[model samples]
Target: METFESLVRAEFTPKTTFLNTASNALLPARTVAALDRAARLRAEGGALDPLYADVEACRAAYARLAGVPVERVAAGASVALFTSLVAASLPPGAEVLTAEDDFTSVLNPFHARGDLKVRAVPLEQIAEAVRPGTALVAVSAAQSADGRIADLDALREAARQHGARTYVDFSQAAGWLPVDGDAFDYSVTITFKWLLGPHGAAFLVVPKDFGDLMPVQAGWVAGERPWESCYGPVADLARSARRFDSSPALFTYAGLRASLTLVEEIGIDTVRAHDLALADRFRAGLAELGHEPVPSPGSPIVSVPGLGRLQPELAEKGIAVSDRAGNLRASFHLYNTAADVDRLLDALSG
Candidate 1:
């Protein structure tokens, strides 16, 4: 596990052995660096120039991580609002395909819209459910409850055959797995989890060219010149995904920048390998204790049914985990190691 450990490990002190990464990641010391950097920026006369630079830096960093052009990635306050914007861009009567268990941020936009037809299907049956009228297929890269990952390739192919766009919520999978950014038309990731950023910052990725697309949420920041004038009309929408971004939060961006830097320095592939290995170890240990988890395709999230009641008790012993839908969920991140898994397993076994 040390092979995968980054120097950033020294900075983490969550007060408990946190296996609740799926809920929210523990903050890193690097966040302080970003905060200090922000302070320095404010100390100077004008903070706008450098704050904006941080925004662009974030866009660039996420773009590089997602393996798409920088133009495709946008700075967002949250996945929920931006996704609503994307869903609203669809024409009236456009059908959106999704699963009941799909993350709220990914599917809620379609569900909330009266004009759009939202069809809910089981994740496994999404391929068969894609109809010709389907405008978009919204799904999570990995299920938040049980850590079951969707087959993006099959989903993309199904959406393609029907001329539909696919939106993937990579909240759980992005920094821990090799996300197929090209397979989907749009993808969203809130950085607090695997990306190790703050709560408010998220990244939204769009394709280089949408054959037919409309802008639903046009804020001043989405214009060609956000700094120029908010009162004036946008003569031209931004050529890039920046068009979706509203006002960027420089304070959150500072922490996000540091987190992205950590992810970059350690490399995502290395982080993924570490995550899976620990997950495998954790599951195997649980199985030995006669509390085998429900079978799942490889995912950093591992869930054990009937353990929800145990979570509160375990936390008292300095072991933190998440409980959802009557299941105890243990989420492994880059910061977790074999030892953390042992601590969790020991708590559960006891």
Candidate 2:
């Protein structure tokens, strides 16, 4: 197995502990270079259309990472907007199911519409809630608050049995967990969390059969030919999942593609292994500090007691972490090491 130490070491800083990758991963040098390249190209002011190729490349990368076909992936700015778009696509009177406290990105979209019946149940009880008439079942691949990994395989199976479409927000799981696109009909992820890309870069994957489903929010980029003046007879749309995409900035596409190139080079399986090992260390160490961590196998997020109380203090010491539901959340990505966790533990103890 090739070690990723050098690759990870080169991308980020050593002084600060960035445990809040789940909030937003630090942009790598490669991503910055990509943004700069795009900026230079934009300054030239000729043929802005070719930059759309970057959007396609970004979508293709997400497709491969999600184990889905290129046609299933759509680029977007954020998961919340895409999730809401999918919710809006559902027919009126549709019933949407999710965990009672699933991420706002997962539940808020359905609830905000007030047209569909949104049922928020316990994670364990979600599958049982599925019915033949259920329109959609959306949940996070891993809980953001305390690193609770959902049983997606089982959930998808149950949803399939009930003829329900399954949706997963993989913002927290994409780089670490393999979200099976063949099983789930729809999935979305913001790459900044786990894929180590820029903010405002995200993807939504839809089933190939969804070509007939009109987009609830489509910008000019989603048209058959964005450069052409879309006059009368607006019948033709993107044949691929691109139809659902909004206009992501050119830099967003470039940044996502660049970071994804590094992610692919290091390899997803290796990153997953490294991240889990660090999380395991963090969880064990937190327990030794007399604080129980939320147990979430295969997830990089480890929840500790007094996280919110400690967040400001830890930040003062250049240790970055995020708080969720009153728990300290230390999220480990490929860049984190055991020393980082030790620093957090030491800070809490002192």
Candidate 3:
């Protein structure tokens, strides 16, 4: 397809037509077909063999896309953020350094714990904040609010100097940007956001050596060879990050697998190009409407300064955007087009 319109026409559902793919993507018909088939098998109470196979395939697909070994990939809810905290696993009262710009979900796991100390520093000061006592330096590869990409390489070097590990939350970056897990010792990602998968599915990548350090959580399925052991004491912590994952949610796995397969078929570079082009269009359109774009040449995210105050009016125009702390966020993705950007500009003009 030469344009986003063609791609959407071919791949998306007609009833859900819209370019707000950054919020929650409209799954392709093929994904829906696969999910339906999987659900049918589950409904019939047949062997759950296919579901397990799909889960493993999903893990492998996500690992390949992330440039990490399948053994190092872990699955869970908010897996990236949770895995980062788990990777820290520091002694009580030890501090974990992160940015104030991070999504609230990243902070929740650490905030809920009393023993672990979480420190939020400005993005500019993150490198300087990684001290000897800091166990991990966690940050997003791209800030979710405004789509500003982080300097992960610099953070990684600083963490290395202090003998601390780096954990990157790539939920907003994956699928739309290139990610090298080696940029940090660990990286967390959610399949839902940029990966365009179903909600409640995420992946965590831990460096090989740190895999065994993950503390086991509830559920017998988390045990090594769970099906093989009846009630035997859980022995031999898993040698890979799979040790951190509990039982697979088969329904979400089915959706995630289909989504990843679609992404792989589209290719990452192509997706990035589409996202950046749309972002540039959005920035240009916002500027024409007398609103300041948050940052020039922004990533998939663009902010219109005044839209935040006009949310109710904009919603009436059939446009969906977020008003966050005084900025209206327009997030671009593979499905957006220059026409969509123009439409948003026109809405803001009034």
Candidate 4:
């Protein structure tokens, strides 16, 4: 068994002090190798059995990570697709309560439908704002711009009291913060960021009874017997949440299988501890330098107000981060270290 330190050393060889996992994650060497192998297999007309197997493996892995039964997990290409499906399922005048500054994908689907009455509230007020008329409470588990952790327990309790369903996006939370998919009526996550997977994969978790979704974008892959139903309407839609699945992204899933393997082996609890320590170190450094970061306690992501202008300068210094809505955002992950955090702080201070 590889120790955590040994596993980190084996998987990563960074070219820079990478502190931007919130925007895009650095791929592990093993995942890159898997991508190369997938490309070669496709170019050589090799058997695609391995690629298909990777898809199922990823579905099962995500199910385990989200603490849901495999039957409730539906594979998709993006969070938007899943959100839109949920939007389409709602009644014409249903009300959706959301965080005003939540990720656009989470908010747009409800608004675009034109018929739903969408209401936006401040993140802190989400739970208090839920009412009996609200049909769904949609928000990210972590704010994308500033990394403020949502009070999911409070929101869930309020939603239940109001008889409103919950749709939580775990895209920014899953790899480091432990998630419970069964806690919400629905949840969506993209695999590229914290999960350290390729770009073409996302996941949606529906309730065990499949909830109220209509499978508006269902393809042959949503059929109970996909290959057999290819040229016609599906003989029968999947009895499970697989009915919501888009066709699997085979090559992307092939690489994700390797990435997710690393995550499971390392354990989310271990990753969270390592990431938060580095993030807090950076926060302490920012305070010493007379800068105040957005308060995001217990989160690996830190956003410093009035520091967005330093992004380009730090990038030139080989320290990666993001400038989001005028805040300098840095996200720490299992691969980062005290040295990496110090390097970024040093660059900023200088």
Best-fitting candidate, scored by TM-score: 4
Cα displacement (Å) at residue 312, model 2: 0.4
Question: Candidate 2 lDDT, tens digit per residue, 1-350?
Answer: 44588877787764689899888888888888888888888888767665688888888888888788898888888889888888778887899889978889888878888888888888878888888888889999888888888887788888989888888888988887876777788888888888988888788888887722578676676777765515544356788888888887788888888899989999888989999999888777777878787778778888876558788888899999987778888898888888887888899878
Tens digits of per-residue lDDT for model 4 on 121-203?
99999999999899999999999999999999999999999999999999999999998998999999999999999899999
Worst 10 residues of 2 by lDDT: 227-236
Using lDDT, give the best candidate's number.
4
User: For residue 41, what is the lDDT in candidate 2?
Assistant: 84
Candidate 4 stretches greater than 4 Å from native: none
Provide the lDDT at 286 for model 4.
94
Weakest lDDT window of 10 consecutive positions for candidate 4: 226-235
lDDT of 1 by residue, 75-180 (tens): 8888897788778778889888888777778877777887888889988898889988888888888988889888888888888899998888898888888766
Q: Which ten residues in a row have the lowest lDDT in candidate 3?
A: 13-22
Which candidate, 2 or 4, has the higher lDDT? Answer: 4
How close is every model to the real structure, measured as TM-score?
0.94, 0.94, 0.91, 0.99
Worst 10 residues of 1 by lDDT: 1-10
User: Pairing residues by index, what is the TM-score of model 2?
Assistant: 0.94
The order by descending TM-score is 4, 2, 1, 3
lDDT (0 to 1) per candidate: 0.82, 0.83, 0.74, 0.94
Against the true structure, candidate 4 reaches a TM-score of 0.99
* Candidate 3: tens digits of C-alpha lDDT, residues 1-350: 34545655576643322445545666776678878988899889889888888788988998898888898887777654465446447667868888986887666666666788789998767888888888877788877777777777788888989988777888888988888876677788888777878877788787878632545463455566767544666675566676777677788888788888878888889888888888887777666767677673537877666557776566777677777677788787776667777877777776
Regions more than 4 Å wrong, model 3 = 1-8, 14-19, 80-88, 230-232, 296-298
